[model samples]
Target: MLDMLTRWYQRRFSDPHAVSLVAILLGGFLTIYFFGNLIAPLLVAIVLAYLLEWPVMQLTRLGLPRTLSVMGVLLIFAGLMVMAIFGLVPTIWHQVGNLIADVPNMFNGLQNYVSSLPERYPDFVQPHQVSTFMITLREKVLGMGESVVKGSLASLVSLATLAVYLILVPLLVFFLLKDKEEMLEMLSGLLPKNRRLTSKVGAEMNQQISNYIRGKVTEIFIVGIVSYITFAVMDLRYAVLLGVLVGFSVLIPYIGAAAVTLPVAMVGLFQWGISPEFWWLLVAYGIIQALDGNVLVPILFSEAVNLHPVAIIVAVLVFGGMWGFWGVFFAIPLATLVKAVWNALPATEPPPEEQVEE
Candidate 1:
């Protein structure tokens, strides 16, 4: 067993590049595991810098200096951030508060409906079963309410952290964008002299991640705006809240849409019951989702990472379990990084078969 293990190590870790890659990956995982929260601002800055790089390059191509180009992009980003904070945040917060305030009423209505379920379908649902379900549901709802309250209190306590992120992220993004080439050069200098495989993998990951993040941001804005207009036209309550939910739902691909649908349907049901207005609202929502999935996604992500559906889902599950929301958000890109590295690594050729009389 010892000899076999030694042979395996010698065969696999023989290449210097392979050994270096393993060390780098282990080091990276350890760093992220240990200081992930502390370095979140830097990670966010890196993502923002990557997203803004294209526009900055376009400006540079149009005869602007790189510094001026980065400044212009940063200014636009800052203005947008300010607008979101001032214009959107307060409205969303109000809607969220309203939603929370109405939750108890919603639960009461749900309980009443569940209570009547047995009468409506006596053969299908017994009163005792309904009672049991209602009890369980009530407990779950109470638990959810308590969790929300706790989360709100926690958020208040984390205001300082949030402020740090707001300040530090922009500053880091600015410096990163301004010193992009120099930074790349410095990082590259740290790597082995013969780093063709590493460079290839890095280039591929950079392209895929940039396209994905930029395209996703655009998709969210487009979907949110469209959903908001549709909901407002239909006189739906919590239109902005639903719109934002629908917008961000695009982040998790298959899961988000399905999860968000319950709330949208519930709100519509309570608002319009079995009316044509409710049906029309649902139809419009469906159309928007269809257009987003079938049309908008293809257009925006024409050059996006081509991940298999199963692979994407697995990545989401694994990363989400590991890092929660950010993990879910970065799932595809992380998966793509894995794919790129796998492709970059040199494959071992099978040993040649020795033939005698055959």
Candidate 2:
């Protein structure tokens, strides 16, 4: 047993290219396993870099110093964030206050409506089932909201820290852009000695990843702004907020915008009372999504994320089951990683259809 194990270890360590499969598998396993803890912030940093680096690069090309370029991009994004908060927060707060004042009436109306349902046509859902679902849901979010209230002020305090992190992200992005070659060399050196092929493949993978990240960020911004503008014109409750949500959610692909639509649309329906305006709000979202799905995403994600819809969905489900929102956020990148691996393998000769099993 010891001799067999020793031989296996020797074979594994002997040839770098031969061990590629093992290394890839182990690395993937570790990334998936430790992703939420080790990867989330690093991924966030990469995203911020992609967002800021375009203007940074352009400015550099136009004769600004690289540091000055990064600084300018940082300032612009910061101003936008500040403007969004100022414009959106107070309105959302007022809506929340109004919603609180209306909740009891809404609950009473809902109970009356449900009570009428069981009486008007029996043999279906009991009131208890309805009550149970509501209880479970309230238990989840309000229970979470309790934590939110307690931590709200702390979260406000974290703004400064967040700003610091944002600042760091662009700085890191600038350095990544400025020292791209040196950084690649240093990172690639992590492979075993003489692993030239492995290092070259790894560098190629990183290049794809960088472009994908950059492209997706641009896609999100475009989708978000378009949605926000449409919603604002319709005067939807928290239009800017919901727009931000949709735009941000659009980054994740299919299910991202849908999830945002639920709470946000509910808020609109709940506050606006479902008139033509309410229906228009729903239609507005459908149109925005159509625009996004038909145009914006196709243009941006087609190259960056070449995976089929089924593959993208499966990645989201598997990753979401494993990690939740962060999983969704990372799905495209993960899919791209899968595609890189799939394409790297040599294609097998096709079997004759006649000889294949029925």
Candidate 3:
């Protein structure tokens, strides 16, 4: 066992560069695993800067100074943020408060409907079964209500942290964009001189991650705006709220859309029952989803995220378990990073067989 372990170590770590690479990877994993929350703002800033870098570069190419380009990009970003916070956020908040206030009524209606299920479908559902299911569902709903309350309290406590992130992230993004090359130089200085593999992997990851983040942000906005307009035209209640849900539903790919559909359908059912309006709303919503899956996704991610559906789903589950929302949001790019590293690393060649005299 000792001999085998020794041989394995010798075979893998014989090169000093390999040892350095292993150390770097381990150190990065540890840093992220242990202090991810603490450095979240920095990570967010980095991602935002990366997303904005293209526009900055385009401006520079058009005869603007790099500093001016960075400033222009930052100003545009700040304006959008201001619009979202002032214009969109308040409406969403108002709708959310209304939803919360209506929860009791929703629950009561659900309970009544469930209680009637056994009578409506006597052959399919039994009274006892319906009773048991309703009891369990009530408990789950109560638990969820408690969780919401706790989460709201937690958010209140984290307002200071949120404020810090809001102030620091944009500032960091500005500096990162303004001194991008200098920062790259400083980071590269820490690595071994001969780091071809590292550089290759980094470059691949940079391109993939940039495309993914930019495409996703664009998708969210387009989907949200379109959904909002569709719902408003349909005279749907809580149009903004539903549209936002539909928008962010793209984040988790297969799962988010399916999960969000229930609420949307439920809202439509409650408002219009099994009427033409309900069917029409669903048809329009379905068309949006179909177009997103078949058209928008392919266009936006044409050269980005070549992951299979299974791989993407696995990435979402694994990373989401580890880091919640951001983990889910970044699963594809992180998976791409893994794919990049795997492709960058040199494959081990099998030892040649020695021929014996016949």
Candidate 4:
């Protein structure tokens, strides 16, 4: 067993490039694990730079200087962000406050409905069972309320951090975008000279991350706008809030859509219980999801995501546990990075079994 392990290790690590690749991967993982919070602004800037790089490139192609291109793109993006902050955010926050205010009434209605379930389905649901369920649900709701209160208190500090980010992120993004090549050259100089494998992986991830970010941002806006329009047309309350939820839901693959359905259905049911309008709203939502999965996703992410459903879910759970929302958001790409590294690594195949096995 020791000999077999040694052979496996030697076969895999014999190449200098493979060793370099492993070191680079380990270093990156360690850095993120240890200092991710400390360097968050820089990381955010890097992500935004990736998102804006394409447009900068296009502008540069049009004979504009790169510095000027970066300025133009940064200003446009910042303006849109400012607009969202002042215009869209307040409405969503208002809806959120309204939802919180309505939660007690909603909970009472739910309890009343559950209490009726025993009579409606006497054989399947007993009074005790309904009582147990309601007790558990009430506890959960109260716990959620407590959590919300804690989160609200915590958000005061977060707002101050956000203010710092608002100032620092764009400056970092501007320099990162404008001095892209110079920064790359400097970073490359720091890496070991034998970095062929690292370079290969980096190139693949650079394109993968760029495509994924662009496709995702586009998906969010398209889904959000369509959902908002549908909800508004149906006179659904908190259309903007629900729309934004539906939009961001795309970030988590299978889990997100399934999770968001409850809120949409609950909102609709409470507003228009068992009515044709509620049914139509669900149908429209289903169609939108179907089209997004079958059409928009394929068109937008033709070459971006190539992972299996199981792999994707595992990535979401694992990386999300490690890094929270950003992990979930970049789960697919991170999984792809793992896959790429696995494929790129040198491996040793076991010897074939002898014919005597038959």
Q: lDDT per prediction?
A: 0.85, 0.70, 0.86, 0.90
Collision count for each candidate, in order: 0, 0, 0, 0
List, residue by residue over 44-104, the lDDT tens digit for candidate 2: 6666775566678789999998867776787788799789789877876776676556666
Per-residue C-alpha lDDT of model 3 across residues 151-211, encoded as one tens digit per residue: 9899998999989988999899999999989999999999887676777777877888888
Runs of candidate 3 with Cα error greater than 4 angstroms are: 1-23, 348-358
TM-score of each: 0.91, 0.73, 0.91, 0.94
RMSD of each: 2.8, 6.5, 2.7, 3.3
Which parts of model 2 have CA positions greater than 4 angstroms off? 1-18, 21-25, 28-41, 63-68, 79-102, 119-171, 193-204, 272-275, 321-326, 347-358
Per-residue lDDT of model 1, residues 134-194, tens digit only: 8898899889879988998999989989899888998999999999889999998887776
lDDT of 3 at 357: 79
Superposition TM-score, candidate 3 onto the true structure: 0.91
lDDT of 4 by residue, 1-358 (tens): 9988877877788779989999988998778877889988998898898899999999999999999999999989889988998999999999999998888888888889889998899999999998899999989998998999999999998999999998999899999998888999999999998889889999998898999999999999999999999999999999999999999999998899999999999899888877999999899999989988889988888764467889989999998988777788888889999999888887865455478854
lDDT of 3: 0.86
**Which residue pairs of candidate 2 clash?**
none
User: What's the lDDT for residue 149 in model 2?
Assistant: 85
Q: Which candidate is the best by lDDT?
A: 4
